[model samples]
Target: MRADARKNHDHLLAVAGTAIAEQGVDVSLRDVARRADVGLATLLRHFPTREALLDALLRTRFDELTARAGELETSSPSEDALVSWLRDCVACAHEYRGVTALMAAALEDAESALHASCVAMRAAGARLLTRAQAAGTARTDIDGTDLFALVAALAWLSDQTSLAPRADHLFDVVAGAILTSAGNSATGTTAPRPRP
Candidate 1:
């Protein structure tokens, strides 16, 4: 690509990242083009589709998380790494409205634009989970899929306005369940319930 065209592409990505962060992945492509001072045709020329753009945006984060997992393998205890990375996954999903749903669908669809990224993320979390289980810090019965489901559920809860005040506590309670000490006890728990 020519220097000028490369500049335009970078500018579009920067603008789109901000727009998506502020307005969500569902934000208008036209608005992104306008904010980037580029034409719709230019945006399409660069990204082709909304999924393509989201894939680009998510790739860096996924790579970072994967790298972090590798670092934590050497730097932290197995259980600590697993729990910290799970929280990170929830935060990443919460960055965009409706992304938890997107992630859940992407995980099972190998052909989806987000599939490879999701797979990498799951693998990273799986490494931590396996380590934790082997160390007897986390339940051996739970696998990476269960951890992913828990993070996605937490991210979904984060999107609910009614859960604002109690989200943190609920996260603690849910995330704690992976620990062997949580012991399947519901006694004295005040965790919020799903709306019917």
Candidate 2:
């Protein structure tokens, strides 16, 4: 890319990140272009599609989660690291109102521009998950895919206005299910009890 083109790309990404953070991921592409003082054609040239734009915008956060998982492997206990990473994934998914949907779709579509990033993110979680399971702390039957689904579900549930306030509690419930230790088992005393 030319110097001017690279400048525009950087400007657009900066502006779009701010826009999405304030407005939402669904903010118009044209709005992003206008905000960046670039043309729609230019934005399209750089991002191609909404998902591509989102993928770029969220790339840093995704990479951070991946890196955190690796750090956690050495810094925290096996089960603690896995649950902590799952919480981080949920937080990332909820960064934008609609990010979880985009992530969920990207996970299944290899053609998606975000697919590679999504795969990397899951692989990081898988490493932590495998460590936990090997330690007999997490369920052995579940894999990274299941972890992704659980994160997605947590993200979605966190978005529901009616249930949003209790989402953290729900996350703890599910996390307990994922654990298989003496006290942390799904039916154990640490599990969240259902409301009458």
Candidate 1: count of backbone clashes, pairs at least 3 residues apart or interchain: 0
lDDT over C-alpha atoms for residue 24 of model 1 = 81
**lDDT scores for all predictions?**
0.79, 0.84
Write candidate 2's Cα lDDT for 1-196 as tens digits: 9998888878898998888766767999999999989789999999999878888778778889999999999998888888889999998887666787778788889998778888999999999999988887787778999999999999889878899999988898889888875427432426422222
Best by lDDT: 2
Model 1 segments beyond 4 Å from truth?
1-3, 182-196
Distance from true position, residue 73, model 2, in Å?
1.0
Cα lDDT of model 1 by residue, 27-135, tens digit = 8999999999888998999999999888887877777888888888899877677767877788887777777778888888999988988898889899898987777
